[model samples]
Target: MFRNNNLSVCWRLVRREFRFHKGRNLMAVLSVALTMALFTVLSVIIQSLVGSVRDYCIHDMHATEEMYRQFLVSQLPELFPYFLSFIPVFVCGFLIIYNIFRIGVDADIRFYGKLITLGMTPRQVRVIWYGLALAVCGLGIPAGAALGIGGAVVFEHEILNFSKIPIGMIVSLKAIAAAGVLSLLTVFVSSFRPARITAGISPALAVRYMELSGFERKKEKNKFFPISIGTGNQVGEDDRKKRITPRRMAVYHLARSKRRTAVVIASLSLAFILLSCVYVQYISADHDIYLHFITFSDYTLSVEGAGADGANISRDLEPSLIRQVEALPGVSRKGALYKQEEWLDLGEHVYSRLTNYFESEGGWRLREMESDVYWTKAYENMRKNHTCIGMVYGIDSSYTELLARPEQLIDGTFDAELFAFGAYAIAEGVEGGGGQPNYQVGEQVEIGGRTFEIMALSIAPAYLRADNDSAESAFSLGLFIPEKSFRQLYPQRGIRELHLNVEEEERARVDRWLADYQNTKDPFLDIRSREALKETFDQQIRSGAAVGALMALTFGVIGIFNLANTLIAGLLSRSQEFAACLKLGMSDRQLLYMMIWEGVCEIGLVLAVVYPLALLAAGPGMYLYLTKVSNLWAYQYRFSIWPLLICTPIMLVAAAGIPFLCYRIIKRQSDTSMDPERPGAWS
Candidate 1:
């Protein structure tokens, strides 16, 4: 009978709390609902895409048997790791809900104290808060599930249309069930601390617990001006007469509540950081893609034939076909190069000696060693019997000129002297370091019993055929020698590739000509156009940007929700203070202005923290992407501030709008309660 009475009393308290704090409760419910909806929608979309990819790979018209086998054996096994990405979303949702409830419970500490004084047990208090939480979840989860299903259907339709996949939405019942469970868990976990605080508070202390403090008050006397003042003695006597402003009062309140201030700033800053990082990623990717295509020739023509090498094609082109291509009406200029596989006779002792020099000499000067006549002679004598195989390119002045611009050279010049003096140039085969021969300009190296001077050191362009999987290139340690010397050494090797430039208006004609030529005269020739490559890159950019935008939006929503909750809690907590200011002759308009100032100050603080950190983090990532992914030698890191600039005004408006709206609602309720015309107005 006592337990039943306790339960009845707790239920009555819960109903009363809900009735009086309807707005706050509603906001709390919406916050949970929104988080759940976002999680469910994201999960549904991911599952749909995974299913679609699996189906498309299995039944795709273009997929080879080997590709299908590889997807099944390798890719499908790796799908479990992708679920780990959802952990952050779950954590952020928990934090949001926890923060909202903690603020609410803290504001209502006195109310709980009152209940405790009314003979309610601590257990009853726990039941009241827990029951309220469960009730909110019961309403939120189902609504979220419905919205998630609708979102999934829309997403599936778009994805299928874009990918041309003939698959229906594979809604995962298991995933939906998991989402519901996670939502309930989040609510319970978030409410646990608040419930404990409420249940544990002593009735006497709770009733008198007026404010939170970061530090205990000290008795020390200091000549410090209060934040509430508009001006101080520091600014002289005349300035001290200035009126106390609402803005000053807001700043004072913010200063007093350091913990709350920090939490609000952190929440807002984190979202801004995420947004800025996304912008950085998008810009970096777009820049890298552009750099990749620009590093190659505008148009390329090549031939392949069966050979002893793994290549089912020989490293030779037909002279007649080259002549015909060069004579085409739309052709502006042409260049050719002969690529051949060869062996480098680096003596067995050479690798060991270089390794020793790299470790012990404090620095490696092997490039200078090649130029030193004495060292070259020593190396030649020591390595006479050792040989390592690599690819070598034989090019004329025209071919060198047709490569990427001269600025792409990392250390040396691309001059006519390279071919004129029968010299070779070395390019680093790997990114960061290593790969290239330790040879510098004016150096001479003997290959196949003939010595050639080193005229340049450069970054390898994308057009040069090299191993893609490894850091070191098959040609990095090899050579780029003049065609004359190349022909003398390997007389049988002919031109295997040619690059051509065509007038802008005549690109279509040239494309048509090449297509016809490949169809009839030489089916072995492969041709690619710059226009087609650009289109492919554009498509990739659009799809990637779309996905990035969606992720940013999700994080942005969480942040905005957090800001709104913080503003409402902060404003409501200071209701008595605002009421006191009104009694002290401060107008309602001034109070509204104070709220706006507070919002703007929060946004400004967030920007100050987020921008610099985001840029600093983005720098190294952008550098690595340029060097490794794009193989760019002359790439410049660009900081995109446009995202910050564009988002600032929007954030400012949201910050100001949320507080003003909350203040208006609270003020109206206060007015209605104080009216003499209303029944039980005093009560």
Candidate 2:
């Protein structure tokens, strides 16, 4: 019998809800559609952009195979981990939309009493209401999901060929599924039981009690802001006298005997948090990739030129006009390094060997050279050790004074004696053919078929030379060689690339001039500034973030707006309660003020709770996600105080404003012009 009653009640509740606000339900559904559509479209656009950029980064940029390896290794840890970070996002989204749904719940109760008085059983009513909520949620979720996924696919495949990537298909599918499931869950959870509880309330009590309504709450204030002729005043003077303070009054109004404002507030807070999280993540990632531009101290420029083989040369630079053009630039020292295309048969097999030029004592060598401006002691040691193979570099012996501590030498080497020989010297990372103790300062090593004694053994950058497994890695390794000796090893290979450190302010200007130089002389050369390259990278990251946020925003807005509509509906239902307050002298201003205050309080409380919760959930989740999925060492956590400070006030205003507007509309519709003498006409 209980089961049958519950089932009957559930159906009745659904029918009543549908009957009460047909248009509202339709509008809510439409809003959901729009939100889902926008979200889907945005996701595809961003993903495509990211895909495009990723290809560029990997294939075009030539960032070294080791870098690629490290990238993959860093991400390998996340291979098996679920993309659980999205869970918090969904939860937060639900919270926001749930508040909107509560409004509907409130309205359901106001009318529930009317239905109960007619004949509905409490048990039956409860079941029916819960059922309606579930039904609506179920329908809404699939609809929203379909819209979201459909939009995304259209854009990804039709507009942007980014869907070509294997992962792109998977991502698109996941996004659609997630959006659909979350939307359904949020509505179902929010709608369930609201109407049923209202039905269970004592019908006698509901019928006898004077409920609150927008017009009834403003009777006294009507004297000042007179109610419309058709609107009826319901409250008496005594009710208004009980509440005076704006803040307290507002609290009472939202809290009322049945508080839905609290629920609404909770919803808004959740939505805000989700939006903020997505925005922050996206913005931060974009900034991270472009941080080089924001904080760059040197004017770095990448000069691209071609070589006959793997090497580059100013001589081979084309119409020969480029050299003259380059010389004409805002005068500054410019040198180039070219690794001529060479095939070396190491006996076993031929491996593509790309040997970059480093200036050494005799000439050039097949090693990497770095101008060490930090250590003089180690610089001196390298000078004594001539044959430190893999690496050769230039150094300013004077800076050795800065690295005076022995610990510096033990760790990074403070010796400057290494720099004097050949205007360059080998630091470390090579040994004799067989396998000698890893070459140290006092040891001898062979590199490029030349044997030289190590003046000093010290660690200075390029620590390890290897690759790891990962799609995203940034690692570099090579032997350090001095500048003067660079000519001896690769005297034949021309300069292919030049790394220039210019003044930060002059970087752009310098790049323009260099580009102009390259264009005039050779069509084959490509000059890229760090700024431009970084911009491309940043754009890609921004696209990915936008995609995630779009999904969140879709369900979030649908939930919130519907919640707002429902809140208003419920507020209008309590016409009798509001009538008492109105007659008691509560002015229109006071009532409106109270309503706004109620909204503010509710939203504030919810935010207070949710902010901490979101942080707790998202913080560690993001850390683990990034650490496992990317080559990044650790996920840096940051909270921008400004966003919260700025958004809080805005959200408060919006929350209050929505209810106030609804109250006015309802008040205008009520018949207030009827004289007091006609009290029993409808009563």
Candidate 3:
């Protein structure tokens, strides 16, 4: 008898099944390809970025093996965000691959049972399903590798070029191979559960399982309803109304495949959770942007031509415009720094302060310091003109915070209230010996006939007056006085610098207002926003925020694809169920309503699941991740909830609309409203 030897026939039959379910198979292939692509891209991020950092950024180029290991350990935190990108891709891969084979096994349970009745063994059935997955992987890996690597090249090129990073694109053949192997391995592992499910189902169990598949013909008392597959007169009419309503029937449908429905919801939730992570870690981080070069606030307005014809150019940056800018609704905080470069006659003060630094050290600190040229210059200026050069920087209360960096506060505090009360801050630590006078906190320094207590001394770089000319290495003694006091001293210098923060939503509006003013009113105003400067600074890392966006987009697309595949395949496989529902007098409108309810339930479940999961990631998980990295030193646990505002609507629309669109397509394509391949499914 052929019963024990018909293995070839079963192989051919499953091959036919794959062709028959080509849409599902195609989705399987796409998922595999995308997973492979994500993996390949991750490999590139590691090899290219890590290698570039190791080669270029490492302090110890001639490092020992142990040192190299330490370097890698140190960089892992920096690499975490790139790793986060692949998580959603992996989730989508798992759910889609697992769902594809699970649905296959359940749908073809009776077919496999028939095959077993003829000759096939459990081992053969398992091999057949595994082989089908292998076939999908075989088509997917190469395509995915090419796409992933190529995309990384394009993206990294733009990133590196904009960031001015001197790293070239690196395409590792090994990474591609590994990606392919991993994808193949994932398919192999993901195929196992469904294979086991198919192999373990005995013929009797397969016959009984048909009723649970949502397509079993109703056991009607009236055999007249032969086409009924989704509903039942097997129960009383009252029972149908009370128990077997479409709502309950949908719940039963989902309850029967609870694990599968969970997989779908979990897949959807992972995308949102990752997006929220991006929001918390990347968006918040971007908002907390620090630019060492950005002086005080969001935008600074100074006269570009003030360096040349300062008084005349300063006149162009009018008091009227300052008032207009201050009155601008978007401008949150504004302040002015009125400067007066003066040569005060500090004859005795100059002689003492200039010699103080050299006298403290046993020897000259600098080669220039050893010379009496500075001494001669200072004494001669005092003796001849009875004057020494100095700068008076006028600041409002807002600039006190900028003047006192933690490391640069050599002594005293930058208390704003104290500053407003006639206290002055002095910049100390001269580059080549002549800087702020040796003045203790509470000591008085004279400026334009006003005596003020030195409340603080800061060596802040902004106060350093750094110049490219090596000869001009020394910083002059500069004192910061309150804006009102300085205006009383130098009223002609209207405002040297104006710094202010603009509301983020109103930045563009303010920018437009400034642009118009600059074009028509003051071309030499020299407006600089922290926006452009921060963009350049972010370009230095090519923006982790940008990487976060790519992650959200990639995951969103994959999530959409998975949802589409699951909903469409799940619906298409159950044509007989819809026919049965129609025969049971469930109208098309009612069917759509039930399906819509299913989608709503899925979205609701996703929302219910994603909140805690995201919170868990944002709370302790974010804390842990943040503590491990040096680059993210400034990052705090401010989890942005804006991703919900974006993903929720997209998910709601997808969940509600996918089923409607799929059913409409199915109906419009078929005049009889039955699958062409499954006869008597409707009639």
Candidate 4:
């Protein structure tokens, strides 16, 4: 009977406290709801995409039903990595929610103390607080889940029209349930410490505790600076004055509660960092995609014979047709590239040496080499090692100039004249064995029975192919000789690629002319303009940017919410101090200005920590991406500062405005209780 009475009292106290602080309670609920909504929506979208990809791969890419089944079985382990990535998001959400709840509890410590004095047990107090938390989560999680489903639907609609494969909005009941459960768990865990703290508050201390000023005074430390005898007294005096301004005092308030300050800073700065990193990643990926797939030309017209793989059968462009196109009104430049697949003999000794090297390096130790088949397959195996097969391109000096620039060259120089005179240029091989290839500049190598000297080593272009037989394969081991030398070596070889430069305004007319030419002269030719190629990938770029923007906006909102809570909590904790200031002849306007300065100082400090930390975190990711893609294509890292620049002012305004608004509200509620004539008011 006594326990029941205590429970009733605790419930009444909880209800009264919540009713009095409705705004604060609502903000707490909103913060949790928004975070859950973002997590759910992103999860739904990811699952839908994975399903779409699986379906497409099975129906369109797989050659047989058996292959599709096997592929599905093999992909079971991939889900683990996806689950692992969510751990950080979950941790961040927990921290944000925990900090908010802790602040809320601390703000109302005196109220809890009053309940304790009214004969409520600490256990009953904990139950009341935890129960209130559960009620808030009950309202917030379901609403958040609904919002997530709606977001997923919108995302699906945006992508469906652009996708080649059919896609539909898929809402997984299991996923929704998991999200709600996770959110509830987060709330419960976050409330645990705060509830305990509230329960332990002493009645006597809580009733007398007006503000954090006493604690701040106890913890404050003074620093001494050394000065020369001649410059002694005045040196430290100026520094002391500078440090004692209103702005510095505001900063000191923040510094007084180190843990709260750190939490708020981390929450806001993490969101900023994530947004910046996503934008940077999108820019880098977009640049790489364009560089790899698009050739260095305003337009390309590929000629081929009728075959299943059109590239397998090369066809020549008639000289008369080329002349006619060049003479047309808009042509600025024209060049032809002849592509031929040829096998070069690297000699028996070189083949044996390479095979021995691979064996010594344990390249094939995992595979079983049957003794019976080894002797039978010796000639064929040796021929595979001795033969280097690649697409040999014939280009003129102008085309060489259109390739990678001088800085891309690892050694020697991009001497187009030398290349035109039968000297060959090798691309720095893909990363393997060592940083560079065994061969170097000025080395002589025989190609098609003719000797050629290596002119330069450049970063590999995307067009080169690697020989699978060699353990250490060079991406740019293929030949690039002058067109004159190419013709002399193989008189029957025909032009396979035609590159042209046209005026921007005349591109459409040129495209139309090319279509007419293809219809009349050679139906096997494929023509592509730079604009058309870019348009083909337009949806991909839009999707990337949209995803980044959505993530930024979602996390950004949560961060701002956290900042507001911090400012409100800080101000409420120091209400007594502000009242003391007012009684000491500090005008309301002055107090408001000081609060605004505090807000500014908080955001300024957060930015100072966030920018460098974000840069440090993003640097390695950028490096790895650049190195991997650089091997396949030429690309440079571009720093994306626009997102950061745009977000800065928004954060500053939010930081300053939140505190100022909270102060206004508190003033209107008569919480400061200023008395100018009271004794000790000036003190």
Candidate 5:
């Protein structure tokens, strides 16, 4: 009977609060909906992209079907970005929900005091508040989930409207469930603090609840001082001046409700900080990073891998085709890395290390190395006389530029003129943890039974270098020498690969031309271009931007919504105080000034808090993007304040406008309007 009575009272109290505070409850529902919707939309989009990554790992990275499942588990970098978004989501959600609940608690202090007088326990009060959040989540989550799935489809087509990257919408039950769980957790966490405040209120203190102020501040007595520490100074009432103004009152209101103001300020600051961080990340993710790191040219045509039928660059990539490509209407500059496979006896020590690398790294792939006859022959040779098979790529001055580029250089020097006169170099793998160089700079190594001076140790970027096993390993011991010398080495051979840049407008024409030529004349020729690679990189950047935009939109709107909620809560809770001020000669315009000052105060605190913290977060955020997450070696950390600057003005306008407008609406609805200039108003 006792338990039933407590339950009945809790339900009635919860229902009354819900009915009385319709606007506040409405805002709460919207906030919860927005939070879940952002989470759902982001999850769907992220899952779709992760699917794309899985396909790439399976088809491109050559991970087998069984290994693919294990690969996602072992290498989950694909999920890191999606998980990273939770920080802002939870933060924004907590602050907004917490501020709303705190205001509700302040407003209900008297009602709670009466409930305590009726023998209700603090535990029951806390449960009431928790139930309050539960009520709103019921209405919010489903609506948000449905809109979120729709948003996923809309955002997909939106991305395709601007970018070449295909982003298909994927609606995952797992993702929706996750969003729901997180949304509930956010509410539960946010409600805990406010519930505690509700539970801690003293019935006696609550009975005297007056202003927005919760706790009683200790009064400090004023002390008077005389000039020059002399007792002869006399206190005189020369003039009586009223010092307290609307601006001062606004400050007092904010100071009294410190917790509510702090939550509001923190929500706004975090939104700005997160927006700036995403902007920093987007800036760091430049497509040029990939372009410069790969080849820097617009297009590449390679026949190096067409050795499947024993047909190679020497046999199929004719010189006449190179001339015709160059003579095309839009061809700018041309470059090529001509290649012919050669084996070198780089001594016993180097051969031993190469053997270890092949065994350790090769695992199972090298044993099934039947890609072509050339690799098989090379592997067989390496097993025999400690010989390592590698390509002798003859590069012109243009290809030599790749050799000496700061990003590509491992060691040594290359002068195109010197290289033209038979200066040769050993090519090392740029990124791998392979063993030390087989031949040092300036050291002489024999290839083709001919000795040549090693000019530099550099990695050949792009398609010229291929993974090697016990066989034709371009990664382990490739050779680069001048083109003229390479012609002498293999006079009748054709160019290995042709790399060229074309005018931006004529790329389509050139692409069509290359496609037709490859389909008709030489079907085995490999064609790659900067534009194709660019779409991949751009997709990464644009996808992130779209996701970031969704999150930013959520945070931005919620922060403002939270601010409005807090302000209205304050205004409504302290209506008696404002009425007293009006009765004491405070004018309508003065009330407007007070609210404007409150808005200014909020924006001021946000600016003071946001920029310094954003700098700290953005630096680490930028570092993680460049060094830890991204594959772009050319992206350098460069800090810019433009993102913050762009976001600040808008925040300022919203902050100031919300309070000022809120006051006008609240004032207009008043049943009785007091005139400050009325006789005896001061009394």
Candidate 6:
């Protein structure tokens, strides 16, 4: 009997609310729509991008597979420590997306209180509005996701292709199911706050703002226009000229509900802004990086080889094999450069406990000695003239361009004179030194147990790695010499490694072409291409993205709940205004129509402000990061429409439904509000 009476009372009160504040109820509904639309537009875009990140990075790159199988095996101890660095980015992304969702819900709560004042019982009012909000939110989320995902997917695919690596992507049904259940769960939880607020308010309070009853705050009237007159206006009708224009009304209403508006817009705007910024930055960075890599001095395919210890590949393999690799498709300028390690012997007093002294009486050190090796540049710090010896590479004139060291000239030019006398291109600061000053390009120096003219100084552009500790770092600090100089200096010493450059685009093809040569008599040759190296690099990026996305989703849940709560609370607050209309003889159907209209208006307003800005902000940055910075060669940044088209309706309906349902419940319980005193003091 109690339950039945409560139901009857609730219906009666909702009917009364419908009668009293029809126009305001309409506005309240629109508020739900607006917020939902905003939520939908932003969330879809962000979620889609995030989803693409997961798909392309984890599935396409197979980052985990490569890490465990290849790179991590040799450095297991360092691997675990390195994996710990990706925590912050994920945490931040989740916070941003979740906050945007919350803002949408908060706007609903802001208008809910007014609906309560229209005679609708709190319980009934909550049901109607909560339903409205849910419907709008439901429509918006998917649309936004679609829009964001569409563009992201295309770019992601391009990135994968450009990297020339494949990944094994698995679609986890469990994860999808979990996402679905969780989203529904969020909707359920978000609806409760407004329900609680509605149930707690008294019927009397529902007739007007019970929360503000004690305050008699006076608002200053705007009188910006003193004597404005229109063609149809008369002096006697001056007071009526204070009508609010729709745009002004919207702004005025939002301002008047400053606290709620601030909560909603600020949260939503932040989400939109953050997602846009991150997407833009990441894509832009990638694009920039790729463009830079393509700008190398030579459109040359790089050949990296590991040879039998102390064996020179160029000397071991027939020149015919080198020609074979160079003949591959897109093979452009082809040349071989020497790479090898050599022991250093320092003369007596010049070498302290830190240095090992070796017998330098022989013109050359034996191959395979493990004496400590140091760059010539390090000698300056020793402050003493010391006889030290390390191996040198002999190179042809073309080798200078291959090493990207055309600037290694000091006193002499790179002309035939320097190339003829076995000219050596030592590093910038190293030359013959005793009590004498450092040698210039014109002088001859005793290096690698040979006398060679300092024909040029190698001022090459050194390579850099993400972390300064990569292989290129070591190479940057090494010395260079012409090929003739090495043979003249150490006629008996052997070559160590040989590097070949092919057409830049044919690095892989050249590698394949060399496969036959590698299989034949030459067990000492090991050829590697830049494409393979790039594959490894791409894998690293995908691994990072995977780690980042997981963490982002975790924190995003909290934000989503907070934002949803805020929105529900605001929408429920409008119940009083809805109830007032019902009491004043407005039809239930009419009230519903007005509420629907309001939801549409509010959603439209939010979309109007958010979508384009989100697009504008995210576009250039995303293009730059993906194509240039990340060096995702295949990525193309384009404005995507799918997320917008898809998420818009879902969010709008979810946003609209939350409040509509709450209001309907109030209508069902319209009678409960008839006896104002019985409903308690706040009412």
TM-scores for all candidates: the values are 0.63, 0.60, 0.60, 0.66, 0.80, 0.47
Q: Give the better candidate number (1 or 6) by TM-score.
A: 1
- 1-683 in candidate 6: lDDT tens per residue? 12222455554544554445443333333333323222332233333333444454344333343332333244344334223422232233333333333333343344445544444455666655455435534554354334334433443433232222242222233333333333434444544655675556554544454222243223323532243322245445555566323233334334344444434444444445444544433342343344334323222322234333321123333555556655667655434445433433343432542232212324122111211122222343232434332334555565566344443333445555545555455543322222112345565555655555555554333221111112212212234676666566555644333345555566555565566655775654545445554555455455444323323332233233333443444445567765664454445565565555544555566567667766766676565655566534434565444434544676577556755775566655655665554322112
Flag clash pairs in model 5.
314-494
Measured by lDDT, the strongest candidate is 5
- Ranking of candidates on TM-score, top first: 5, 4, 1, 3, 2, 6
By TM-score, the better pick of 5 and 6 is 5
User: In candidate 1, which residue ranges exceed 4 Å CA deviation?
Assistant: 1-95, 114-192, 213-257, 277-296, 303-325, 341-392, 400-459, 466-481, 484-494, 511-527, 531-553, 572-591, 594-635, 667-683
Q: What is the lDDT of residue 190 in candidate 6?
A: 45
TM-score of the candidate numbered 6?
Answer: 0.47
Which candidate, 4 or 6, would have the higher TM-score against the true structure? 4
> What range of 10 consecutive residues in model 6 has the weakest lDDT sum?
464-473
Q: How well does model 5 score by local distance difference test?
A: 0.71
User: What count of clashes does model 6 give?
Assistant: 184
What does the lDDT come to for candidate 2? 0.46
Q: Rank candidates, lDDT, best first.
A: 5, 3, 4, 1, 2, 6
Report per-prediction Cα RMSD to one decimal.
9.9, 11.7, 12.0, 8.9, 6.3, 13.7
Task: Return model 4's CA RMSD, one decimal.
Answer: 8.9
**Candidate topping TM-score:** 5
Model 5 CA RMSD to the hidden true structure, in angstroms: 6.3
